[model samples]
Target: MAAEPAMQMPSLEELQHWTWVFGQAQQMMLEQGLDMMAHMPGPAAMSHLFEPAAAFRATADFWSDTMTLWSRFLTQEPGAPLGEDAEQARDRRFRAPQWHEQPLFDFLRQSYLVIAEHMLKGVDALEGVDARHKEQLRFATRGFLDAMSPANFPATNPEVLEKIVETKGESLLKGLQHMLNDMARGQLTQTDPDAFEVGRNLATTPGKVVRRTPLYELIQYTPTTPDVLKMPVVIFPPWINRYYILDLTPEKSFIRWAVAQGATVFVVSWKSADASMKDVTWDDYVEGGQIDAIDTVRDLLGVESVHAVGYCVAGTTLAATLAVLAARGQADKVKSATFLTAQVDFSHAGDLSNFVDDEQLALIRSLSSDGYLDGRYMAATFNLLRGRDLIWSYVTNNYLLGKDYAPFELLYWNSDVTNLPAKWHLAYLTDLYRDNRMVEPGALSIGDTPIDLSSVKTPSYIQAGREDHIAPPESVWKLTEHFHGPMRFLLAGSGHIAGVVNPPSSGKYQYWTNGRRVKSLQTFLKGARETKGSWWPDWIAWLRGQDGQTVPAKGERIPGKGKLKSLCDAPGTYVRMR
Candidate 1:
């Protein structure tokens, strides 16, 4: 390892501010919230949407600024402050002495930012295009700017050069080794892959696989306490990824926390879809997936109903299943519903919406020749969304800095790839993103039943991450408008995953709450009260209030009366399939 850079680093306050900047962008960039739309729009990815005149103006201004910064580079000192954006101080990428103390590198940094800012402004100034097209352009432009940062290139990056010199070329050698290792694995090394394992440290929650269906396997977690909530809790995790995200390490696991709180928890572990499952439709997910999950929980527990929870796309399906059931006059099957960053209404579906038009649809079909759209494509799109962090940061760290990434259970779960069934994924994009049909009265038909969200009478708790890029909080907010129920909408302090999976024990981010239904999301945020710590407690308290009854835990783990038996352990075969 090379010695630390001689230049002083930014203060803690400045670092925190940069984190804020990144947050707004993750909150800006990319699962996405649902599989409906996360990839870049074909048109946006191919070219810029800026007007020719605006482009010229932006380039001329950027050129002037670049020349000005270059000429004055020698006059600046490492300690000299970049004006008070407060955000730039926090970038974290250019921390070495050369980046600040040296003139050329600092000029490179400022020049990139100058042109990037102007380019975005030009996109904003674009005319003759709809707002959706404009947003797509802005997002694509941001990705390009993030990729073009001087810090990403070894030749241009001062920190990497310093590392090579300090380590006498050992850093470059080690970087080649790391890059080659990641190449062989077919994924970026964001964390030490050896640090975490599924059943060993990650999803170690004690439980049994109570039921197995073609689409998923239902795992009921063992309760830590002797007594448990009368209503068993069933979770529907997004099929786009593994269920273990909610069941991470015991310390951070939302499932473990709920079980410890005297609630029985069951999660749907989706199978990594393959060509055999390519024909599977969204209706299967609604009926065969979530419906099957809840039915197993109710039947195996010998109960009539249970509290239902869903994350990401699963939440979308859960809501649809509820609507379908409610229309069929079986609304009581799910006593209450909790949605974690799920968007049922897609009208304002952020940057991802541009990825759902006819052109993109044709492209997806071509890729789905094997019955599934490779999940890696979606993961890649998400990486592009947060390229500065997920993509470039790792490239700089693993392949340039000659340093191994720290073990992050979240990133591990993220890298544990899962594929999507072509039928279900396509239906999601077409019906939801392209057509905006989920919220329509009878437009969506799951299991031959017309889906009507208004008919869903179950009490609901809707949670959205404030800076969620994958499922923009604003898109999640639209669900509050469509779902007819006694609803509680909350805005958590971080982006999608961090916001939702945040454990109360960390005492990290805060959550905002507005019990009253407001007309606009902005209004909700305005009148909302902010509370420090995780929103897990608030959700649990709300869950308990739905029904204060209890049940004996002694034999509840013994799912099914006599015929049904445990197929496997929790975090079952399906999750480990691929």
Candidate 2:
């Protein structure tokens, strides 16, 4: 091997300058170390150090401004606070308070994590690093703390002072973080080579084919025991997310619950998108994806109609599909409709609306110019909106104090990426969020026919979470007003994901409905029947009212039946790239 050129040595002047600077850094560390010790509060007062009282005061000020703005937009009488009158009427309501008017401490726990952040930065700056280098160091340190999943920050070993004031502190933090990364890497390798693989496999697994519909290729849940129902209940999951959120785990899996109910269940797993799918539109999903499923089920099961359940975005799409069918007087195909935390109106939408302005839309459009919206970008936006929980919580725990990452499969699953076809997203954002057009009859055309929500006379059950920030209670309630059909709106006990996945065995989750309108859903459920087991059984009973007794066998389908087969397989290709 060739010898490298000899490096020039530093002059005595440069060496002397660095030596003096290093000494000054050591002096500063000694001073700050003394200051930290002297100012450190006793155990009784220690909690205040991490409380960040100033930050809380700042938060209170911000929310005060926000509440004033939001209060004006409530649909009730101008004087009363939003949702309060509705709550007053509810017999079994929590009187869920809006903390915007309250002190910040009421909303967030005093995070000692903030103390860890302050200590890390203060020590790094005292070490004589340049401002830029110090910032980098700060971030790296924060990431380490975030990974650790520490219980609380000020509570960490006071001994961190001993390590940080010396060169040894830097090495200790770095070494511990490195070990943690190695362990997480190994654990991840066992479960999934990459995050997307977990869902990809679940989606693609072959089983008994319940129905081969044009709108989808579905996976049927095979029960471990004897069969009950002949015609299957086919689920239409929104294309926005992967299908397996329903089959999250053996314990809480909705499919597992359904199988236990002795009903044959099938779920539509959408094909992942690629450049070729850029031209696929909302119409394609309905006409191509959903319409085909109706026909496919008719052929495969010999059943006249199948019970259709749509989740979130899928529920909206399903509602529109029913409208088209109803317009054509073809409502006989779907027995009854069930919506899980789904939205039908954008009126009085939540803060997520702030994310859908022209500039952001343009940025997304530019991205789709390449064929697909990078799912990672979409995920980042949603994650940032809850930064204190999703981003900062992780940052403080993993990067700052050098801790091991927790094995949270749900979080891991959420991080897995999936792509959105450019055409589909563009239409959805413009039509749903921007125009709020879906509520109007014939505002959107499905094929040659006009889609109308009021025309949807299908018996319907809609569920929403009281605490869901994604689709607020008002947003979900918009469905009942628009459908002009027999409707039951249930306000579940938790947030977005929990409301939908709630199993009855988890205890009584309240739902609401009567022949007449109640002041609020929470109030209505108070008077409604209390049931055991999952709500799925209640839904099954509703659908059974509309379904035929005889189970049909497989027959034939249109030419497009095989067109979607090429798109099959798990994580399907669209979810992997991001």
Candidate 3:
């Protein structure tokens, strides 16, 4: 048979040109449609014909306020100061120092603000649309406005113009190369490629992989203290990211810190899912992944019970495992539980819930029909959620200004994403995201047992990031009500990764604790006492209180020395898969 010719990939410039052309076509079509609409009765007039008078009045009032703001801004004297809130607004697009100094830039910025406000109000005023559709429309409109901002274009952006003159066009050339590199990779570059090496500068903490499965590896970190707690600690980090995030550097490693605090720490390093693992599902993860890890920990330590910690999605999985165990009459195997930025209740999963509609899920399923959700696609979704900071800022800095990204460890880990098996991804979206079934009694089942969070009687220490969007603080706080035993919830001062990876030595962020359980998140925040420093110390103290008495440390041994045999070294073969 004759060989089929290989498909040719488009050049970066060709791709960019096509994208520009398509965008221009869409813009023209939209403008023409709006122009046609203008010839007919206007939206306000049409609303009066079909909608309630009160709705029309509200729309008119919004436009009136918008016009008043615009009039004040346009008629203001040249060089007059902006309002305090506008000056202090955290929107980075308008943060160019020149915007405040240059009257033209200031006008453009304020004009964009007014337009965005009106666009959102217009979306809200659409009468026939449901609340969910209205929200999606508003979100889409905001994204469009953000993308069309003058700050993203060299001709309109004062900062880019300044850079062009300063660098004599060299900046633009360098930026083009950076953009091309990102294009080839099919995503935006989040950090400098030359910043850190996996086995050297990052994920360098010493440990040994004591057990291995097709899905994951159990890394038993060497104990640092002369003596350790009688009970061991095992951590289940989310599989979406490499396990090294918990052991990024000796200075900031949560694993290292826990080991140093006289606890035998173990972590699960999930293998990057590929075509070979297409059949892997939530049942496989709970039974084959986490349950196996727990059994291995018990066998290795020769202990009846161990302290378990879960982060993010892994936390969700761990909670389910505990419930499953309780159902099986084996709940005593786990001494206590610690959940970090993990949510069992997906009812209020923050802005991420906005992207979980039926259409989006269908699209994702179609894309991943080959049996895995590509890691790059997942990263892009997350980047889009925080587009201004994660996408456009990089476009402006790396492409417009032609500067290399700074060496950031967290970003490096974030960029190293792992693919998710198709079955597991679909199940997660359907059961947890679409249905919010994890917290509902008997709605979720792993194997033959139905999972229920309320049945898990383990005392839990739950920590939530105040700014977490993936798992909102309120959603995480809801766990206090589900667990049957004592619970302590701590609110940290940063977003997801920052909140979880904070080290006491950094002394950069703070945490809050009311030292009492409260059902309402707002009430908890109102009564919580703010404490400056990492939440690690407070967590370690809490863990110590829950853990058993100290005993002389055992000498380190390879996996083969124990019942669970060896697979590879600490950071593990699975973590290094991709």
Candidate 4:
């Protein structure tokens, strides 16, 4: 059989041209249809015009609001003077003295052409149209006007305009300096691949890796290697991001540390859901994903039970999976469950609540009716949550300073997002965020069983980050009360990702663990032991206690036929898909 040709995508310029052509075609069709309608005496065409006009006006107002948003952001900062050390440091590192022009020029050139093209069509549509269709054309015209308005385009803002005038020639020097620095540092991210090599060594010893599991394939880590672990640990990473984050580098990789300590580790690398996987839902994720993974590990390793660790949204799904397991009396398969900055409750979720309200949710529902939450939309929402850090800060650094943006590998990795199945996203928002249903005993049902976290009796480890805005300390720590387990609530010092990936080697990080069996987080932090160094050592020690002693011989080793077959090559799709 002959190989079919590969698919091709158009360049950005081609895409822009096609976009203009499509808009023009739509406008022509609407005009012809309107002319036909005017000739007729029905109200349907008139009604159509009204809805389109209203939508246009709404969009116009939206851009108008956006034009003013930056000013609001600037004012919102306390005293509006960059005095804080963190902010100052960021400015010094990113800001180039008197750098601003190319971006502003580029913005102006692009916006003018796009706005002019669309505005002209809108104007022609409205000019000699019957008064009956005027309202509809008015909206389309208004949108064009909004786009073309000086206030909305280019370096017209006082700060931006002034920067252009003041920092013309000096920016060239600064740009050159930055380029030299980046080149000296070995590319832009300063990523040391040596770190990966070191971590790989720490994780895989000589004659230890008997079989490597293929990426995105289900498999078990067994006793084939002499360095086999006693505690069977399976890590479920959030499909929203890459799984390798847990094992970013040698100094930072959590998986490497666990291996060194003799703990069997299994990690699920979720496939990036595409058009084919659109119909997948929250239930599918649990049953076909994490649950399937759990069963695979159990049967392959021949273990009575296994320990499961969930990160972020993965943690939320894990909680739901446990509820399903307990309801069906399959909870016996789980030895213990750990949640890392995971939320089962979302009643008072901070700023994110602002976006998940009725109007936005409705917009999402309408846009994602095709069964996949567009990854771009998800990225935009996350960008908004930390607008200062993700949006404006970069704008100031990149646009204001005529500096070429050097890619940070971490940020680059983060920008590479995976699609969320539309069904799963809607269910997640409605059931978990909008309704706060997961924590409720019977609000959620998996198959025929209702999930009751209180019924979950497995030993649990709940880690909440002190600085996690997405999953606040209070919101995440609340999971302890829901789980009727011998639980340990540890407060890590870093944000969501850093908190869990922490290896005691990183200096200045801390975590709190109360020696006494505390009832909840509020009480536990009161007299908790403030430990220094990495939380990795602490987690390892905790697992050591839970893990059975490592046996030296085959006779003493746990008897289990490793039945799980390798599905793909090592360093699977889960970690590198994005």
Total clashes for model 4: 5
Colliding residue pairs in candidate 4: 214-568, 214-569, 215-572, 269-574, 504-534
Q: Which structure is stronger by lDDT: 2 or 3?
A: 3
Candidate 4 C-alpha lDDT tens digits along 513-541? 88787666778888888888667777767
Residue 351 miss distance in model 1 (angstroms): 2.8
Q: Give the worst 10-residue stretch by lDDT in candidate 2.
A: 103-112
Q: Rank the candidates by TM-score, best first.
A: 1, 3, 4, 2
Number of backbone collisions per candidate, in order?
4, 32, 0, 5
**lDDT (CA) per prediction:** 0.80, 0.58, 0.78, 0.61
Model 4 alpha-carbon drift over 4 Å, by segment: 1-216, 219-225, 517-520, 551-561, 574-578
In terms of TM-score, which candidate is stronger, 2 or 3? 3
Provide the RMSD of all predictions against the true structure, rounded to 1 decimal. 7.4, 16.1, 9.4, 14.6
In model 2, which regions exceed 4 Å deviation?
1-216, 223-225, 505-534, 548-578
Q: Name model 1 segments beyond 4 Å from true.
A: 1-60, 74-84, 559-563
Which tens-of-lDDT digit does each residue in 1-578 have in candidate 3?
Answer: 99876535446565456445433543453343323322323223433222466445644654564445344444555433332255337677777787765645665565455445545555565676556555655566666666766688887789889889888999999999999998898878878878887878888877778877789888887777788988888899998889888888779888888887888888889989888888999988899988888888887778888899999999999899999999999998898889999988887787777788777788888878778888887888887777778888888889988887898888888899899998888789888987998888998799899998889889788999989978989899878878888888899999898998999999979999997666788989899999998999998788888865877776443234566566666677787776
Model 3 residue 539 CA deviation (Å) reads: 1.1
Best-matching candidate per TM-score: 1
Better of 1 and 4 by TM-score: 1
Residue 331 shift from truth in candidate 4, angstroms: 2.1
TM-score of each: 0.89, 0.64, 0.87, 0.65
Q: Using alpha carbons, what is the TM-score of model 2?
A: 0.64
